[model samples]
Target: MRLLVIMSLFALSLVAARPDASKYPSRYDTVDLDMIVNNKKVLESYLKCVLDEGKCTPEGKELKAHIKEALETYCAKCTEPQKEGTRFVIGHLVKNEKEWWRKLSDKYDPERKYVTKYEAELKSIS
Candidate 1:
């Protein structure tokens, strides 16, 4: 009976030590854009545009569109491996922006002029 209890306790402990398979993957795999972009001129241009937009703009839609275009253009000009690398960077940027917007709610809006400036910067990078 003592051995049986010990075995049962050990089984329970093992179960407790194991993580839930359902939560196997979490947000930890989420990428970081700053790390991916590093000191790349194109990424610098994109970030500059995003910052110049002032984070208070109705022009975010237009600026986002332009940024996507610039990313595509940059990818087009890159070699195959470079294109893959840039894609990874851009993916992280997109993911980060989405997460930021979701977390900030409506607090981060910018003016049209700011957004236009951002769009222009993206265009310049392209």
Candidate 2:
């Protein structure tokens, strides 16, 4: 009984230790953020999808599925590359695409909790 209890605790610890990171597939990590961000039409489509104003491609759907949790957890599950990509994209939006960023923040970060955490670095980028 004691061994079973110990084993259960260990299993639970492993599950709890790794959260959102495991849930998101690394396949998208190779996606070309530069291509998307540099192309206005492409960016707009993704924005529209995320904002629920348009259709979602498979990748967009995958992003939308995890966006909420990613924000809430401050991307706790994100790998290093994922975190870097987020910073780059968000910096671009916050600096170059204020209106869209505002809409996104309003939708996913209405309280500004996540924004507040990275405000300094994001602002300093440019």
Candidate 3:
């Protein structure tokens, strides 16, 4: 019984430590923009996690990955409103982006490339 209990706790800890990254927006295709945008709580939670300005937890990193997946997806059915809404959310999430840039100054503008490309896409929505 004692051995079983210890093993159970170890298993549980491993499970708890694992990240729960979303599996939607499969690699070959896009997901519904509304599916991500309309889910207000999830969107807010992800934004908060990514923008926390602290050491990122696994969950936060997972959320950022999922958000990136959504943002980069090629949803043909996506509407202008959904795109605008996503841009709005992302803009807020990256509002203090100078800090992010400072952290990545040595990376040769990886963040800038993504942000600038996305900004141009957003600009074409009108």
- Cα lDDT tens digits for candidate 1, 47-73: 433434334122222233233333323
| Model 3 C-alpha lDDT versus the unseen true structure | 0.31
Candidates by TM-score, descending order: 2, 3, 1
Q: Please give each candidate's TM-score.
A: 0.26, 0.78, 0.32
Stretches of model 2 off by over 4 angstroms after superposition: 1-23, 124-126
User: What TM-score should be assigned to candidate 3?
Assistant: 0.32
Tens-digit lDDT string for candidate 3 (1-126): 000000000000111121333222222122233343356554444334444544534433533333433333421222333344445434332343334323322122345544455446546763
Give candidate 3 misplaced runs (Cα > 4 Å): 1-33, 53-60, 65-113
Model 2 weakest 10-residue run by lDDT = 1-10
Candidate 2, residue 49: CA error in Å?
0.6
Looking at model 1, report the run of 10 residues with the lowest lDDT sum.
1-10
Highest TM-score: which candidate? 2
* Cα lDDT computed for each candidate against the true fold: 0.27, 0.55, 0.31
Worst window of 10 by summed lDDT in candidate 3: 1-10
The prediction achieving the highest lDDT against the true structure is 2
lDDT of 2 by residue, 4-122 (tens): 00000000111112345564455566556667778889777777777788896666665666666666666665555566666667666766777877777777779987666555766
Which candidate would rank higher by lDDT, 2 or 3? 2
